[model samples]
Target: MNSIPWSISPSTRGWRYAIAVSTVVLVGLFLAQGADLVSEDNEMLLYLGTLVFAALYLGRGPTRAATVTSLFILNVGHIHPGFRIGFHKFQYVISFGIFLVLSEQIARLADNVRREAWQSEELYLFTQECARLTSPQKVLELLCQHARRYCGLELFASLAQIKGAPLQTPRGIYGWVTPAVQGNLLLDSLQAQTALALERIVQSERSRQASVLEATQKLQSTLINSISHDLQTPISSIRGSVDTLKTCELPDQDRQVLLDLASDQIARLQKLVQNILNLSKIEAGGLILCLRWISVEEMVAGVVEGFPAPARARIRWQVAEEIPEVQADFSLLSQLLSNLLDNALKFSQGPVAVEVSAGLNSVRLSVSDQGFGVAPTEREKIFERFYRGQTPRHVPGTGLGLNICLGIAELHHATLRVEALEPGSRFVLEMPRKQEVTHV
Candidate 1:
């Protein structure tokens, strides 16, 4: 609800009072001269009605002024003698006294009613505004604004003790109202509301904090468990393969098989450790990009060559004839594509397709596999750190690859998204054809 405009200037109020009094006086004179419908007593009653109107709508000063003006106009113009202040009858004096007393009593009642109505409206507005706000600081700011606008008071909230009369709640002194006047019921109500709002905001913030702390603790627990399992599996495999080779006399082929098994486990361990390091660097804002213009064919060739010969046999690559070179960090971009290919190979069977296509202003690299496609609901979640989806086969992963890819894509000012194909999932990375590198 909007507030009443009671903050009129003294000059404006004086003009309004003059206009009201003049209109009443002119009507009274017109009745006395033009129409002999009302006697002198009735005319006085008419003036009394004007006084009451002033008391109700124009406030105390106007009411008192109108009372005095009504008495003078009645005595001079409408009394027994024409246009003269001669009190020929004692009854006139008593009538005048009665009118004055009535005006004062009515004015006092009207003023009290007006004040109470204004205070009620202010309280309603304050409560409504406070209800919509969630921050204690915002509520405090609202309190200060309300006090200044409605009460002509300057209010301030402080953490330390205020020297002057302070508006205090049960919790503590949140602020003070300045330029002390006599204690007012409206101001006291505002103080109480402010305190209650602050308490509510503080309690809400505490609950939110508690919920976040609980979530963080849960995430930390999950990370610890996943890391432990990932670390132990590789270490156990390498240890077992080494012990078997050391203990038993084996055929040349068997020895080579064990050696290859140990090597695979070691490679897996290295990848995990490297992923952990990359994640930390990304999170810490320490991963600096060494940007350069690199051809799409070269980048794809480099990433494909990193895989073992057998894994490479299952990979296929295609690059557009008129493809443009993109500005990116070669090492980071290679890592991103390698992670995507590795993820595709682990989840799918048959062949993995690595395709590079050029758009009007960007280049897109998509790694698609003939494996079980990602769930529609899990596509976005798969990019969150430590998030693993339900898969048909037990794919060995720490769930950090896609997240790392996302980080690298962001660093290159690119976008990475997964599309669910009919019997496969395609992960697409799009990078701008040209980039402005402010710092290398």
Candidate 2:
């Protein structure tokens, strides 16, 4: 059932058949000369074997030539009254006819087996390729390519109905081909494989959409819960302070204390609201950068001065000498550093150190705090929105600070990361020394 081992041109095939037949005939003649060796019947069998070889290896034209040559040589050289075409008896004529019939039948059977094997091989390869493709359009394109290569047919898809026997699947009619290719078995098999590949692609897309939907729902729920808890606490504190001032008479000093407490709670509420608004603007792709050249020392000083005197006294900062200026959105960069400093002050009792240093191609700003350092496993998770690690419940935070800082760093094409220190943790932001600012 295997095909001919190799393909040959028509001229080359003729030469091979001639050489093979000549060899067989010469060997037959030698044996025939020895009267005791090959009888006339045995000589006929030798030529018959030559016909079988031609059919299996040399193809239809060669096989037919071999059959006719065998018949002619047997009649003239091996039959009675040798070296003449006349038959000695009617039985000899019938024997020659039967030999011709058997040779033709063998050739026909071999051709059928070879054709079926070839079809099976083509189908197997086509199915294997389709199984690996995830795009339905790609599968369809491959189907057209295969049709053109193997069947000499030009195939194309159309949404409208067309005449002739189009290749139709359950989805709809795929395309039509020339009359010669309408019922080709290989084409039909390719169409079926394409249909299955398209179905698989659709199923995969549906599964991906379902996964994204589930994740979005979970994110929405977490945001709502975090916002509600963070909002209620500051509002309640501000309300209680006001009610006490209005309802009870108090010394001026005590009233002033209550007023400061109310102001502090109001500031906390404003910060929380601002963080939420910034996060919304970032996620909605509305945060625009106003880039300008600014000195690192001045930027650090400005952010430190914005904090309360008590908090600022606990902060120690240094700028490496000769550090060049960087182009960045001043306010956004200031907000990023402020968040890091605030977190440091809230958690650490000892002084927080801010160091600004420059590298060959980048500028590095790091804030280190002497507080409970972030655990190795929780370092990355700490940057996720609304994610708070094992901080005690009494610490008031919305967990949006680090996430917003990350967003700001990304907008300016910078890298932000955390390093655990011996007594606390260090948050580092590295920015390219020179950058082209483009609207995000």
Model 2 TM-score on a 0 to 1 scale: 0.77
For each candidate, what is the lDDT? 0.81, 0.80
Top TM-score model: 1
What is candidate 1's lDDT per residue for 1-440, written digit by digit as tens?
A: 46654422344587657855885787666766754788766777788788778778777777888888888877777774467777888998999999999999998898789878878887988998998998777877887787777667887765345655565667766555454556768777887898777777777888999999998898778777777888898899999999999999999999999898788778777777878888889878888888899998999998898777779999999998999888988888998998999899998877999999999999999999989889989989999988887854356777888999999988888999999888998999998977765321
Q: What residue pairs are clashing in model 2?
A: none
Superposed model 1: Cα runs more than 4 Å off: 1-11, 80-98, 101-141, 164-182, 251-253, 437-440
* TM-score on alpha carbons, each prediction: 0.85, 0.77
Clashes of 1: 0
Residue 16 alpha-carbon offset, candidate 2, angstroms: 9.7
